[model samples]
Target: MSADIQKLGEVDRMIHEPARLMVVALLSAVKEADFQYLHRSTGLSKGNLSVHLSKLEEAGYVAIKKTFRGKYPLTICRLTERGREVLENYRKVIRAAL
Candidate 1:
């Protein structure tokens, strides 16, 4: 295989998936985001978003916090430093491959 094609293999599969990619990209643009905001922004159902968030959390790529906004519960998410590095690398790999 060509060098460019080989670079594709270095892509991070965790962030490469569409839903997680969207969540990561969104988090990259903000300090953090609430569950409802992410839900509306990504158009992902609550369950699906939860699942993806869990995976990201497990991989240490995202940080999730649960707190209360007055009386309402809030789930806030942000990408970690490692997540930022991985995402930047993923972008470079994809760009080189294409």
Candidate 2:
């Protein structure tokens, strides 16, 4: 193959995976979303969603916050500035490949 294609192959494996990509894509559109909202949107199980969120958080691609909404604790998710730039670059690379 070519150097260009090889570079494309280097797409961030973490974000390239389908499930995680969906999670990032969904979060990219909104200001922030709660756990339940992501659960319903991604159709991923609670456990699965939690795991993905943790990975993203660790990557510094997302910021997860726990806050109290009255008597209940709410978990909110949002892509960080760096995350947004990465997502956009991913899109560019994929589009360029096509």
Candidate 3:
């Protein structure tokens, strides 16, 4: 009901976007996930996945590590403590809102 709460709600909404949320959810479930893994799990193309990944990385909610597996480069994503907290808060807010 307060302005601060409303602003927090807006931020929650932004990170809770369908694609971004799925990415976060998947990462939260696993220790680390590769780009192909996320692509398969979310059924999102590389470009779309990259876009959403960039957003999450930009927010510092996720950490992406780049490495090489044989001849190919791998992008492994992990959820940060900040991300977990935000997701938990988001869950609480959603339950309260509903």
Candidate 4:
């Protein structure tokens, strides 16, 4: 249906991408995750994951914090309220379209 197609179009492009979607979905299941954990889970190269995270951070969908863990650099990522809402909306849109 045209209306269903239109709903698909309304899905958030950011979360729609496969890589970003995987990240967001994983984040949704936890309070937060470190860069290494995400890398292992998603199997994304470090550079690719960093780039995707930067995009999400710029969009205010995710928060990234840099800190030291036992003198080691640590990057933590978490989904923001806006990110949760957008992901929820994205799911609805996809469901409706299907």
Candidate 5:
């Protein structure tokens, strides 16, 4: 196998998954987004979104914050510094391959 193939194998699986990729990609572009916004943007069910968020959180790729907007609760998500670097590196690998 070529070195490029091995590099592909080294890709971060956490963000490699399509759904989680979407979540991270969205977070990359924004300062932060709330649960409802992600739900609407990704069109993922609440449970599915929560699951992906949990995985990203576990990987230290994203920060999840719980707060209250008046009488309602809000769950906000944002990319961490590590996450930004990871995403940028991922892009670099892809671009190099191309």
Candidate 6:
């Protein structure tokens, strides 16, 4: 396997968590999405989604925003530039490995 693939294999375990991976994948697919959107799409409970989102945010892969939409509080998440680079590198590693 290539060096990049080998490197990714090590990092893979970190981002490979089911919920976190889903969050990353979904956010990567879109510019940004709300908390409810992720919760609904992943079929995870609010608490569960919150926990995972916190972890991803701590890891610096995602950024969270708190705002009000028509007087209703909203939490929106977006992937960071670092996250996009990591995901792209991961894809490259996977392609090379395969």
Candidate 2's displacement at residue 12, Å, is 0.8
Candidate 1 weakest ten by summed lDDT: 89-98
lDDT of 5 by residue, 1-98 (tens): 66765688778888989999999999999999999999999999999999999999999999999999999999999999999999998877776665
Name the candidate, 3 or 4, with the larger TM-score value. Answer: 4
Model 6 off-target regions past 4 Å? 1-8
Model 3 misplaced stretches (Cα beyond 4 Å): 1-11
1-98 per-residue lDDT for model 3 (tens digits)? 75545655555764789999999988889999999999999999899999999989989899999999999999999999999999888876666555
Residue range with the least summed lDDT across 10 consecutive positions in model 4: 1-10
**Which candidate should be chosen as best, given lDDT against the real structure?**
1
- Supply the global lDDT for candidate 4: 0.94
TM-score of each: 0.95, 0.92, 0.85, 0.94, 0.93, 0.85
The numbered model that scores best in TM-score is 1
Better of 1 and 6 by lDDT: 1
- Output the TM-score of candidate 2: 0.92
Show the colliding residue pairs in model 3: none
Candidate 3 accuracy as TM-score: 0.85
Using TM-score as the measure, name the better of candidate 1 and candidate 2: 1
TM-score quality measure for candidate 1: 0.95
lDDT of 1 by residue, 28-51 (tens): 999999999999999999999999
How many steric clashes between backbone atoms does each model show?
0, 0, 0, 0, 0, 0
The residue ranges of model 5 lying beyond 4 angstroms of the native Cα positions read: none
Which model, 5 or 6, shows the larger lDDT?
A: 5
Query: Candidate 2 residues 31-57, lDDT tens each?
Result: 999999999999999999999999999
In model 4, what is the error at residue 3, expressed in angstroms?
2.1
